[model samples]
Target: MASTHSTFKNALIAILATFPSILFYISFLHHHNNEDHSLWNWCNQHPFLLANVMFFLNVNVLFWFIALLQSSLHWMIGLYWMVIPVMLLHFYANHPMAQYNQLRSWIVTILTWIWSIRMLHSYLRRENWQLGVKQDWRYIDMSHQYGKNWWWISFFAIYISQQVLQMGICLPLHVVHSVDKPLNLLDFIATVICIAGVTIAFYADTQLRIFISKNQKLKQLGQPLVPILDKGLWCYSRHPNYFGEQMWWWGLALFGWNLGHSYIFIGAVLNSMCLGYVTMLVEENMVRENYRANAYNLYQKNTSMWIPWLIKSTSNDKGKKN
Candidate 1:
């Protein structure tokens, strides 16, 4: 039984591992505050110049996309324990050479530590961990217990794997692009977008956490909170955070486009396709499963799918047709 539990924990950790790199890389790629790769003895020579070069990479939006992909995977891995550290290590090992740009790498290391610690906290505090022996069970069993309808664990794992593939696309490019050059307009824009996207995502997540936690307390008191959050940003769109997330990645992709890295283009295309599919297929299905057809149909009628805009329809017309 102990061995089985360990295996189950490892599997969960594997799924979680795919995301932390995205976070670290995104921060490393987009941060404008530092750019030198020098450390102790080795030097990038032109510290400010290298920093400025990275700043001009015009790949901020790409970083946003990567961050979203990683964080999403981390959320799923919340079911497991050991996988969290391992995931962080996986990215840490693959991190672009800090020797090439010590300043940038320093920022990356700091953010990596922060992300790892927070992810660890979230996992430890999760319901699965609190469940003791039951928490030791496999994701398959957990899904069945929740409602055998969608295989949520597998769906999450698939998305996490896709995120990993996107990260792999950058490995070769990062190696080749290691040589630094002068800054450009595109890099400046990427930096700005990266900052903006992170801010937006953080805001949306904060709002969501508050909304859910408040509702959970209300539920415990025998009052039901409406599943639909129709206040603040939620009022404008069913998925304000999703929109912010998409913007973050698309923005990063734009920055990569400026770098003229072919692999960057490849990674962007694949991630874009996956993001589209998630929005239309996986996410749509997941939402419907939880809220049921009628609620979702109504929400859809009045909410934009990816963007935050006014509702185009308010009729739950699809539900009626069905």
Candidate 2:
């Protein structure tokens, strides 16, 4: 349970976490296309059609954004954690036949809300907002943190556009989800895959946290944050954590696919593709940045980036040499 004193802090944390997301969305609609009247005009013409389309589109976009953002996870860790299960519950609730088992969907929604509540509460209590930095300094720092030398507007513009593309994946599933049928073997396999993927992600994250915390004491002594971690899961793949995460979303889509829904494939495929791209970019950049660190370079040379499949070095003569 959260302490009574933390209410204000919680509210502040919520704002900080949600602010960028909300603004990004607003800016997303504003800059994406020239016309701003799409929502209004659609609703004016046919309220029901507009509403359904909007809901469907938004949900798809949200799910895709959540998955991709989760893989990237720049600012809002709290939002990142809750977005997945909440999205799952949302898919369950807003599904067309959801009315038939509205109660079940609602149950899932409530559980998701609870999960969100717990995560948000923890973030507020634990986060060190670094409010002490000067405003200009903070802005410059954030530019480095969020924008990371990338153009801020363009980056988010691309990010939001990606969200739209990501959600587009669900259009097919939306069409098929209305069908009435018993579950099948494919469905079972998809579910298992989804569960395994998510579980692996969770495990990999847990391992990373342990790796970070192991060096926390070193950090307290005014040392820099550990530049590389090659222990535990890190030893296996430079980014087993990222690999696990990418698999999880793809797994979720597969689960949807097992339902024989094409829309679900859209959600999964786009997400996997985006993450796969980002993973390659980030890993390649890391290799260049840590070019001096022979160990890190060796790790990159030897291990797969987003795939667990180990890289076989034909150059067995190329041992770790300075």
Candidate 3:
């Protein structure tokens, strides 16, 4: 049947994507001891940094491969997502060759774990305890636009992009584990910021979910749905969750920044650029829904797009209130 063929294709695509990383890793392990002045020998000598980078990169590539086999991108919301951060923590605590830079590495690793776990928990709940049930709306739209090309395109556009973003944004994992900086006051600041970001994101996502569910119930009762979620975190920022996510990455970057690695900030900055695009897309999607367009525009006028601040009241908001 058609369904069977599709499943087989997805499986094939997943295998193809992951097999290269596995093969390369195996080859590296076999050749690591051959002191021939090549990158392999170099990696063997500096296994602490190189090995950690190689392992995390391979792990994330495998994630996208796993994602390819799923019915939708949602399936990537589990262990595949947590593996790098989790493994980073593990290596720091146990691996003999790891930098294990005292509380410096552990603090960043724990923050990464907390962020990943929080995201994993949120997505699991969002999917109603089941994943692979829904494709991201943008992914679906892209698939339709590209037609049959989407299969191959998905690998590059979605999977490959994820690998880049994950590795980039998680540069702290590489830096913290590779560098031997000690703990300092900056770490305390990083911890507070990281926790604050997570907490804010948690509240934002929870409030949005509640708002959505309430609207669904209203529709079920043949009542009008609430056109806007302007309460709590939403009242302060149009995309508090995005702001919080940015905070989390920048917080982790502080670990490297404190250790004199200013370039680590690039990952966080790139993440912000990507989030900016996503925010634009989400805002567009919101306004396209006729039921909420007017209310959302007014809400936009009353709030900052990313930063949480005092609500800006405009004449439109005042008139609406009257």
Candidate 4:
């Protein structure tokens, strides 16, 4: 894990990660009509290559603007992700490669916009209106790991990596805008799933914020901090917010699947894998707390990590084992 963190901090090398993807995408875009290249002649091999390039290029354009906005993220931590749904809208309207399912694309865009608006509000409140001076704790931790070179390395680690994953997960939007098909009952199911995910996240974050505020008050008064949050959504899953986020991305994948681009699930799956990794880091941090460690360990034993579930007593498991 530490090595992975360092890998991202190697800005010169890490930035190369995106260079190839963008170049390949560009080569794919110009494969037929535009200029060609000898080395990139391989791009013309795939059929969806054109649409994929169109989507990728549009996303890159947005990322360029994100690049400027995120320039201060090392110190400011601004918003770049919420613009994804907007990119989908732009792509759907501008791409001339093929006629896609206009209705389906619009549906996906609207759902994403709702998610974006809610998340934007949540983030701004979390930010407390302070910009440039307040940096994200996660980025702070990483910057410490990278030491003085952090300023430069962060350009790739913080900005470039976010672009990669955000683009990956947003691939469902690309798929929806690239395919032409009739909507079905599955579309309704997908819509429900998407809404459910967003709802769960909204409530979970609300509960968590309340918990944090209460704990902060207790700390300020020289009282014991809450050892564990075992009420509401916290009773079922240790990280309902994470779970809901995965659900939201996976829900979007359903639309891609229904539209015959089932393979777009790769982006969602990879994003989940990364989230799972971060979940482990969070659990490790919880176990390190001297005051909360024991209670957190017990909670960890009974509570589901990603899936919400009823808390099963460990004594019952021990009895069954006997």
Which lDDT values do the candidates have, in the order given? 0.46, 0.47, 0.71, 0.68
1 against 2, candidate with superior lDDT: 2
List model 4 lDDT by residue over 10-127, tens digit each.
Answer: 3333234245545654455555454456434444443345435543453344344444465534532135366545544554444445457778767787888888887877766665
lDDT of model 2, residue 257: 55
Q: Measured by TM-score, how close is model 1 to the native structure? A: 0.52
> What's the ranking of the predictions by lDDT, best on top?
3, 4, 2, 1
Model 1 poorest 10 in a row by lDDT? 55-64
TM-score leader: 3
Per-residue CA lDDT of model 1 for 70-175, tens digit only, reads 4322233233322332333333334344223343333333433443444454444443343222332333344456664423444444334534543543332242
Question: What's the TM-score of every candidate structure?
Answer: 0.52, 0.57, 0.80, 0.74
User: Over 4 Å off in model 4, which ranges?
Assistant: 1-72, 75-78, 314-322
Number of the candidate with higher lDDT, 2 or 3: 3
- Residue 264 in model 1: lDDT: 59
- Compared with the true structure, what per-residue lDDT tens digits does model 3 show for residues 92-179? 4443345647767657766777888888778767766543445577778888899887767876677567656766777766667666
Compute the lDDT for candidate 3.
Answer: 0.71
Top-scoring candidate (lDDT): 3
Off by over 4 Å in 3: 1-74, 77-79, 88-97, 314-322
Q: After superposition, how far is residue 172 of candidate 2 from its true place, in Å?
A: 8.4
